[model samples]
Target chain A: EAGVTQFPSHSVIEKGQTVTLRCDPISGHDNLYWYRRVMGKEIKFLLHFVKESKQDESGMPNNRFLAERTGGTYSTLKVQPAELEDSGVYFCASSPIDTYGYTFGSGTRLTVV
Target chain B: GIQVEQSPPDLILQEGANSTLRCNFSDSVNNLQWFHQNPWGQLINLFYIPSGTKQNGRLSATTVATERYSLLYISSSQTTDSGVYFCAVNFNKFYFGSGTKLNVKP
Candidate 1:
């Protein structure tokens, strides 16, 4: 089966620009998560989705960031007027409910200049 | 928020050598996992060891939930083992350690 897939493996945008990162979770997985890792830092949770509903979004950093999971199949994280501090790797992961392990994507590297 | 710390921060090993990485957490957790991010930035799940011990091939992990600490052991390390190893703990949300950067020389 295909693993969690993330598009635009690398993205570069000017400061104050907008960018959207996409993720396709593995089929039949109800739990999807978004995590980000700044340069030389630990990965931090952004939010989570259970099917089409937002399970928990407490980790979202600020109002400039938005996430959506349509049909509970794919997810998109959009950052408007992204700041230079937003440069980092964004990873998407998915797991079946009650499962022990999570499958992660290759990650998208975003650079804000 | 919970605190997660990993040491020694960095590791250097020779091929065929063995090394151990450690992670310490500040709170009780329901999930503990180890992940290896290769040079290509692919996060691969190595183990989901919330407690006790588990072994897979040349890698093994042990998590003592009571002590809030975990250990990952790599035996007969190869050049391919050079990357970053991260330990993540989840209570409600996941918290990750800074990761141990490993460099294995051939």
Candidate 2:
């Protein structure tokens, strides 16, 4: 089975621009999560999706960020008007509801200059 | 929110040596996991021991849930083991420790 997959392994955009990161979780796994590591710091949770519903999104930074998991298959995180502080390696992980082990992707390194 | 702290913060060891890393959490958790982030920035799952002990090859982990602490042991360390080890705990949302950066010289 394929692991969690993230697109555009690297992305650089000007501040105030918009960037969207996509994640394709392992097949049949309903639990998907988004996390970020800023400037080699500790990784922080962004949100979690259970199938097509947002289970928990308390970690989302601000109103500029939006996340959606459609049809319970894949997820998308959009950072509108990206800020310089938003640059970091965004990781996506998935797990089976019955199990707690998470399989993470290589991560999308976003750079907002 | 929960607090997680990893010991040493950094460690340097010679090849074929053994070492221990520790993670302490502030609260009880429903899930505990260990991950190794390699140089390429891939988080590889090492163990998922919310409690009890489990071992895989040269790596082993023990999580004493009641004490809110966990330990990761690496035997016969290799250069490939040089990376950042992260301990994450989940209650409603996952929280990660600062990570222990390990450098195993060959």
Candidate 3:
């Protein structure tokens, strides 16, 4: 089976610009999540989706960031008016079952200048 | 959010050496995992060990839930093992430690 795949492996945008990163989870997976690592920081959770329903979004950084899982099949994270601090690697992962080890996508490197 | 810490922030070892990386979490967790981020920044799952011990080839990991600590052991280290190792856990949310950078000289 194909693993989790993320589009636009790398993106460069000017500050205040909008960027959307997409992720397609493994077939039949119900748990999808987004995580990111800012420079000089550990990777942190962004949000989670369970079969198209957002299970939790407490980790979302701010109002400028939006995450959506349409049809519970794929996910997109949009950052509007992104700041320099938003430049980092965004990782997407999914698990076939509840509370299982996640299979992660390669990741998207975002650079906001 | 729970706190995660990895000891000996940086380590350098010669080939054929064995090393133990430690991770300490502030609270109990429902999940714990170890991952290796290569030079290219790809996170590769090393082990999914919440409790007890598991071994795969020269890589082994042990998580002591009661003590809220986990240890990842690398045996017969090679240059290919050089990278950043992160220990992450989740209670209601996921948390990752700063990570330990290991450089194995050939």
lDDT of 2 by residue, A10-69 (tens): 999999999999999999999999999998999999999999999889889999999999
Question: For model 3, how does the per-residue alpha-carbon lDDT over B24-101 read when each residue is reduced to its tens digit?
Answer: 999989899999988878888899999999999999999999999999999999999999999999776678999999
lDDT measured at residue A22 in model 2 versus the true structure, 0 to 100: 99
- Indicate which candidate wins on DockQ: 2
Ten contiguous residues with the weakest lDDT in model 1 chain B: B88-97
Off-target runs (Cα >4 Å) in candidate 2 are none
Taking the tens digit of each residue's C-alpha lDDT, what string does model 1 give over A1-113? 99999989999999999999999999999999999998769999999999989999998999999999999999999999899999999999999978757888999999999
* Model 2 CAPRI quality: medium
* Per-residue accuracy of model 1 over B4-99 as CA lDDT, tens digit each: 999999899989999999999999998899999998788889999999999999999999999999999999999999999999998766899999
- The DockQ-based CAPRI class assigned to model 3 is medium
Alpha-carbon runs more than 4 Å astray in model 3? none
Each candidate's number of clashing pairs is 0, 0, 0
Score residue B84 of candidate 2 by CA lDDT.
97
> List-wise, what DockQ does each model earn?
0.73, 0.78, 0.69
Across B2-103, the per-residue lDDT of candidate 2 in tens digits comes to 999999799999999999999999999999999999997888899989999999999999999999999999999999999999999988778999999999
Candidate 1's C-alpha runs over 4 A off are: none
Score candidate 1 by DockQ.
Answer: 0.73
